[model samples]
Target: MALKLLSALDAAKIQLYHFKAIIIAGMGLFTDAYDLFCIPPIMKLIGRIYYLDHHNSDKCSVMPKETQYKTTPTAVVSTLVSIALLGTAVGQLVFGRLGDRAGRRRVYGLSLGMMVLSSLACGFSICKTRNCVLVSLGFFRFLLGVGIRGDYPLSATIMSEFANKKTRGAFIAAVFSMQGLGILASSIVTMVVCRIFAVSSNEPKSETPDEADLAWRVILMMGAVPAALTYYWRMMMPETARYTALVEQNVVQAAIDMKKVLDVPMSEIAEDSPIRLKPPVLPHPSYPLLSKRFLRRHGVDLFCCAATWFLVDVVFYSSNLLQSQIYHRFIKDNNDVNGYKLAFKVARFQAILAISSTIPGYWVTVYFIDRIGRVKIQMLGFLFMALVYFAIGIPYKYY
Candidate 1:
């Protein structure tokens, strides 16, 4: 039998509200993916605009020694890329707790606001020197990362709480699927911006400082659009019934809120009834996460989740953040192209790869995750990844 407090949520029929919740949650992820993937192309553009002469001038022996090759250090570029990740880690820990304490709806809008403001800040990063510019950009991006990371826990929790159990998995999957769209959007926007600047410039083969500077800013600032668009809807959303009924122990309010959401009428109960009188309380015994009982009960599961996530992120971020480097190594004949043109080429390549591979992979997961089960899919994915890595590595090493 379903728990009285949860029966309404579990038994409720899937409706338009479910789709709205998915879109609201998914748009946050879309913004997150767009902001994150957009950086690599911009990073490459930065190198070309600010450091190409220093890094590349030595390669061509005939080049003049006096050539101004102002280069931002590799460490600085890496720092700019990695600092946001660090902020994300912190935000997840901090906001996950905050969401529980303050309620989801109240804290949800804060993250979106931070994302919008910080994205604009990142686009407008300005300073007298290359190092200063990098520092400014890094700081804003770190803040942006914090906001983006908060969405993960908040969105998942909200969607799950709002969904009927029969279709819960699908709703959550749909929300996460928006991330692929965000990635596609980033690539498309970057390609379009770069192409426009490249074609319009009279000296398409030579770097134009003005065009290069404007292109990156435009890309970075565009991340704010999706987040800004969704903010009002997020704010207007009611607190999830799960949070109110279970967390707050306010059964009456929970029923009222859910009635409106599900478009179903709720029966009125006596004020003196047990459901109306129960105070907010935690379902589990009050114990710290590190308590012996918790460790004994769930330690292994927790450890596995943490370890797997760590490994996955390490591989995922490294591959994505360094994709431009891989592209440079494979395509070395772009000397005649200007920095903006090169950036366009990189963006187009990434977009093609995303459309052909990454985006499809997300949908495949969405379709099969419920039918095949998470464990089997995860195991198969890991096995495939391992085999592919070995095949590539062994050949390259021996040859």
Candidate 2:
């Protein structure tokens, strides 16, 4: 009988320094998760501060007078709320290119810087100045999205390149998984800040600046701190061996860099095999999008991944946004008139939904992604999502 071990110590050599790179790279991803969560909470605060009621109110009356005259409802607030996701979609395209061309580390550094600046801007910007608020908020959110855009490819590539194949799966997935933790932490912070502000003002979470500004400012400021600290840390980290090899085409330098991360002697790094260089592939200037053979083959997969992300976000966002509506319509007892309890229930529900709905769904990907492949899982997700949406649209009558 043959003794076939899953991971041989000799075959699967991983040094301590590689773990360091993973930690540095993972920080960028953590920031991405934190920023994404932070945006929604800020939007919630903005809605409350401005008294953006779904029902009739002073805040809703703030829409354009022309629209008001026509009785056609304006969706300015909703559009503002969606700016981050829209920005993220654009960022994904722009920063993906930037990462490929300018190098991941450079683009990653730029992304983190953008995130820090955007978060600070978001915290301090004057909401009272409508145009200023609109422009700044949109610009900053877009910049933040650009940063987020780079994080996915950069972090994943860094981790994969630095790690030995034996541990690559675990390390890469672990880094991505931390995003969930950052999300949970951001939510807790937002809820706490909102609670404090709501209590201090003795106003409902539904109620303007009195109930909203302080909490959102604090949360946005909190989101910036991680980016700023991680920026310094990531700055100190070295670029991956794979990226270095591709750029310089120096096999010896690439091996040395790999050994540096592996913390093993030069000879022990690749079992005494001689390092050989290969010619780099140069692309033509006029290549069309579909002209790239490799990209064309996997283009559908890429589109499916993007569509899955879009759908997941839509469900996640809609589920979260509807919490207040659910509470106001069905859960809250109008006779109680105690806003604190109402807010508490809403917070509790959101916490539950965040835990039950979002976190598990993320893990389901981690577990089954390898088994089913990205396209199959994404297709399944989209199919189920469509079914759920259709079911919701049935709209049975209720009192």
Best by TM-score: 1
> What lDDT score belongs to each candidate, Candidate 1 first?
0.78, 0.62
Q: For model 1, how does the per-residue alpha-carbon lDDT over 226-318 read when each residue is reduced to its tens digit? A: 999878888877899888876777877777777776765454221235565455455675777889989899999999988987887887777
Runs in model 1 lying further than 4 Å from the true structure: 55-73, 265-274, 277-285, 329-333, 396-399
Candidate 2: list runs displaced more than 4 Å: 1-23, 52-74, 166-170, 198-211, 268-348, 367-399
Please give the TM-score that candidate 1 achieves against the real structure. 0.89
Model 2: worst 10 consecutive residues (lDDT sum): 1-10
- Could you tell me every candidate's TM-score relative to the true structure? 0.89, 0.74
Q: Model 1, poorest ten-residue lDDT window?
A: 265-274
lDDT of 1 at 219: 98
State model 1's lDDT. Answer: 0.78
